[model samples]
Target: MNQLELLRKFTTIVADTSDIDSICKYKPEDATTNPSLILKAVNLHENQKFLNQAVEYAKKKGGSKQEQLLNASDKILVDLGVEILKYIPGYISSEVDARLSFNQDKCIVKAKKIVEMYENQGVSRKRVLIKLAATWECIKAAEELKKDNIFCNLTLLFSFAQARACAESKVFLISPFVGRIYDWYIAQNLMSNFPHNEDPGVISVKKIYNFYKKHNYKTIIMGASFRNVKQILLLSGCDRLTISPLLLKELESNNTVFNRKLIPPTTFIKPPVSLSEEEFRWEHNQDEMAVQKLSEGIRNFGKDQILLEKIISKLM
Candidate 1:
C-alpha cells in the first residue's frame, strides 16, 4: 500500500482546504477550512465563479457596497463549506473570527451563529465542527457549545497545556500545530543539528496525544499545520491529521512504507498530572514557543480576515 493507505489504517486523514473539487478527488473523511484556505481558493482559476457569484449576491442584498461585500464573503464561505460537506461523511470545520479568540461569550455566540447559518441551509449539526483558537476563553466557549451538541476543533494549539485543557474540558478535537513549531525552530537556528524523530512540534503533539490516550479522553488529537512530509510521516498513527492538498498528493505518489510510529500512552516516558486553571495558565506562560506562535497565528489570521473583508468592500 502507498503511504496514504498505510497511514489510514491507523489514522484519519483530513483534507485541509476550501476547494470542494480537491476534497472530492482525495475523498478525505473530513475537511477543514480557514480564511487562508478560503481566500486562496476563491482566487484560484476555477473558483472565480464562486467569488463572482458572492459579489453579485451582495449587490442584490440592497445595502451599501461594503456591507454587501462582507455579507457576500461570509455567505460564500458558508456556501463553499456546505458544498464540501456534501461530499464527505464527516464534519466540516468552519472557523470563527480570530478577533474573538479571547472572548468566551463572543466565541460561543459566533459559533452558534455559524452553525445556524449551516442549519439554515439544511446542514445538520453532526456535519459541522466549529473551529476556534486554543485560548482559555475559546475552550470555555467550546464547553458551552458542546453542551448544546456543537462539536469544536481547537486550532492554533502548540503546547501541552492547551491540549490538556481541551481534553479536560472534553472538547471534540484539538489541532496541535506542527508547521508553526518547525518554523520557530528554524527561525531560532535550532534545525541545523536537529535530531530526527525529535522534532519540537512532533514532540509537543506526542506529549498531548499520549496524555489523551492515557486518560482515554474522547477528544480527538489532530496534528495540523504540517511543514513537510517528514512531520506527517512521523505522526502517521495520530488520531487525525489535517494536511494540505499538496502534502496529500505527495503522500499518495510516494511509494514508501509507512507505519504507526507512536508508542501508546502506556509507554510514556513521563508521569502525568492534572492541571488547574492557574497551573494551565502558568505552564502556557512558561512555554515561550506556544506563547509566541499562538499570538502570531491569531494576528496573521486576523490580518488576513481584515484584508478579505477589504476585498469584499471593493467588490461591493
Candidate 2:
C-alpha cells in the first residue's frame, strides 16, 4: 500500500480544501474549508452554481447592501459546505467570518446562522463543525455553541494555552497549524533543513497529542497546515489530519512505510491545570511565536475572507 493507505489504517484523513472535485478525488473522511479555500473554490468554474445560490439566498433574505453582501458571503460558505457534505460521511468545517473572531457574541450569532443555512438545505448540524479562531473570545463562543449542539473546530491554535483552553471547554476539535508554527521558527533563524520527525511543528503536535491522551481530554487533536508529506507522516497516529490535495497526491504515489510516531501516553503524565481567561492571555502572550502567528493567521484569514466577499460583491 502507498503511504496514504498505510497511514489511514491508524489515522483519520481529512481533506483541507473547498474544491469538491479534489475532495471527491481524495475521498477524505471529512473536509475543512477556510476563507482562502472558499475563495479558491469561488474561482472554480464548476462551483459557479453555489455562487448563484448565494446571490439568490441573499435576495430572499433581504437586507441593506452591506448586510446582503455579508449574507451572500456566508451563504457561499454554507452552500459549498452542503455540497462537500454530500461526499464525506463525517463533518465539514465551515469557518465563521474571521472578522468576527474577536467578538464572542457575533461569532456565536454567525456560527448559528451558518448552521441554520446548512439545516435549511437538509443537512444536520451534527455533521458541520464551525471553524473559529482560537482567540479567547472565539473559544468562549465555541463553548456556548457546543451547548447548542454546534460542534466547533478551533483553528489558528499555536500555543499550549489555546489548546488547553479548547480542551477544557470540551470543543470537538483543535487544529494546531503545523506548517505555520514551523514557518515562524524559520523566520526567527531556525534552520529549514532537518529530519522530518524532529521538525518543531511535528514536535508541537506530538506534545499536545501525548498530553491530551495522558490526561484523557476528549477534544480531538488534528495536525493541520503541513509543510510537506514528511510532516504529515510524522503525525501518523494523530486523531485526524487535514491535508491539502497536493500533499495527499504525493502520499498516494510514494511507497514509504507509514510509522506511528505519535501515540497516546501510556506512562501517566501530569495534566496541566486549566487556565482562566486572564491567565490564558498571559501564558499565550509569553510565547512570542504563538502571539505573532495567531495574529498573522487571523489577519490572513480576515484578508482572504474580504477577498471572497469582493468576489461575491461582483456577482451581486
Candidate 3:
C-alpha cells in the first residue's frame, strides 16, 4: 500500500478542505471546513452552484441584507458539508464564526445555530461537529454544547493548556496545528536541527497525545496543519489526522516503510487535572509560541470570514 493507505490503517484520516472533489479523491473518514477553505471553494467556478444555493436559501429565509448575507455565508458551509457527508461516513466539521470565539454565550448561540442548519437539511447532529476556537470562552461554550449532546472540535489549538482545558471540558476532539507551530519557531530562528523526531511541531502533538492517553481523556487528538509528509509520518497512530489535498496527494504516491509512533499507554498516569480560566491563560501564555500562533490564527480566520462576506455581498 502507499503511505496514505498505510497511515490510514492506524489513524483516522480527515480531509481539511471544503473541496468536495478532493474529499472524494482522498476519501477521508471525515472532513473539516473553515472560513478560509469555504472562501476558497466559493471562488471556484466548479463549486459555484453550492454558493448560489446558499445565497438563495438566505434570500428565501429573508432578513436585513447583512443578516441575509451572513446566513448565506453559513449556508455555504452547511451546503458543502451536506455534500461532503454523502461521501464520507464520518463527521463533517462546520465551524462557528471566529468573531464569536471570545464570547461564551455568543459562541454557544452560534454553535447551536450551525447545528440547527445542518439538521434542517436532514443531517444528524451526530455526524456534525461544531468547530470553534480554543479560547477559554469557546471551551466553556463547547462544554455547554456538549451537555446537549452536541460535539465540538476545538480548532487553532497550540498549547498543552488548551488541550488540557478541552479535556477538562470534555470536548469531542481538537485540531493541534503542527505546521503553524513549526512556522512560529522558524520565524523566531529557534530551529537549528530538522530531525523528524525532534521536530517541535511533532513534539508538541506527541506531548498532548501522551497526556490525553495517560489521563484517559475521551477527546480525540487530531494532528493538523502539517508542513510536510514527515510531520504526518511522525504523528502516526494519533487518533486522527486532518490532511490537506496537496499533502494527501503526496502521501498517495509514496511507498515507504513507516511505523506507528503514538502508542496509548495502558497504565493510567494520573487523573486529568482541570484548568481554571486564570490557570489556562497563564499556562497558555507561558508558551510564547502558542500565544502568538493562537492570536495569529484567529486573525487569519477572521480575515477570511470577512472576505467571504464580501464575496457574498458582491453577488447580492
Candidate 4:
C-alpha cells in the first residue's frame, strides 16, 4: 500500500485546500479552508464565477458600503465552502473573519452568519465546522455554539493553554498547527536539523494527543500546517491530519512503510486543571513562539481576507 493508504488505516486524512480539482483528486475525508486559501482560490479563473456570484448577491442585497463588503466576504467564503462540500463526504471548515479573533460577540455572530448562509444554500450544519482562532473569547464563543449543535474547529492553536481551553470547552476538534510551530523554532535558531521523531512540532501535537487520550477527553486533535511528509508521518495515529495537496500528492506517489507513531493509551491519567481566562492569557504570553506565530497567522489571514474583498469590490 502507498504511504497515504497506509496512513489512512490509522489517521483520518483531511485535504487542506480551496482548489476544487485538488480536493476532487485527493478525496480527503474532510476539507478545510481559511481566508488565505479562499483568497488563493478566488484568484483562479475557474473560481471567479463564485466571486462574481457573491458580489452580485451583495449588490442586490443592498446595504451600506461596509455592510455590503462584509456580506460579499461571507457570501464568497460560504459559496466556496458549499462547492467544496459537494466533493467531500465529510465536514468542510469555513473560517470566521480573522479580525474577529479577539471579540467574542463578533466571532459568535460571524460564525452564525456563516452557518446560516450555508443552511440557506441547502447545506446541513453537520457538514460544516466553523473555524475560529483559539482566543479565549473565541473558545467561549465555541462553547455557546456547541450548545446549538454548531460544531467548531478551534484553529491557529500554538500553546498547550489554547488546546487546554478548547478541550475544556468541549469543542468538536482542535487543529494544533505543526508546521507553523516548527517554523518559529527554526527561524529563532532555537533548533537545527532534527529527525522526524524529534521534530518540535510533532512533539507538541503528541503531547496534546496524549493529554486528551489520557484524560479521556472527547475533543479531537487534528494536526495541521505540515512542512513535510516526515512531520505528517510522525503523527500518523492522530485523530485527523489536514494536509496540503502538495504533500498529499507526495504521499500518494511514495509507497513507503509508514508506521503508526501515536496511539491512545488505555490507562487513564489525571489531566491538567482547567485554565481561567487570566491564566490562559498569561500562559499564552509566556510562550514566545506561540504568541508570535498566533499573531502572525491572524495578520496574514486578515490581509488575505482584505485582498479577497478588494477583488469582490472590483466586481461590484
Over 1-316, each residue of candidate 3 has an lDDT whose tens digit, in order, gives 9999999998999999887788889999999988888888879999889878878889898999989988998888888889889999999998888888889998888888888998999999999999999999999999999998899999999999999999988899999999999999898888876664588989999999988898888999999998999999999999999999999999999999799988998788677458779999999999999999999888889899999988888778
Q: On TM-score, who's better, 2 or 3?
A: 3
Each prediction's whole-model lDDT (CA): 0.86, 0.90, 0.91, 0.92
Please provide TM-scores, in order, for all candidate models, with all chains considered together: 0.91, 0.96, 0.97, 0.97
Runs of candidate 2 exceeding 4 Å displacement: 192-197, 266-270
* lDDT, residue 265, candidate 3: 85
lDDT of 2 by residue, 1-316 (tens): 9999998988999999987778989899999999989988889898888889888988898989889889999888888888889999999999988889899999999999989989988999999999999999999999999999999999999998999999989899999999998888788876556654478888888888977898899999999999899899889989999999999999999997756887776667666778999999999999998999999888998999888878888888
By TM-score rank, best first, the candidates go: 4, 3, 2, 1
Give candidate 1's error at residue 124 in angstroms.
0.2
Q: Write candidate 4's Cα lDDT for 78-190 as tens digits.
A: 99999999999999999999999999999888888889999999999999999999989999999999998899999999999999899988999999999999999888887
Error of 3 at 19 (Å): 1.6
Q: State the number of backbone clashes in model 4.
A: 0
Question: Model 3: runs farther than 4 Å from truth?
Answer: 193-196
Query: What lDDT is reached at residue 303 by model 1?
Result: 85
Poorest lDDT segment (10 consecutive residues) of candidate 3: 188-197
lDDT-better candidate, 3 vs 4: 4
Worst-scoring 10-residue span by lDDT in model 2: 189-198
Best-performing candidate as measured by lDDT: 4
Error of 1 at 97 (Å): 0.9
Better of 1 and 2 by TM-score: 2
Candidate 1 local distance difference test against the native: 0.86
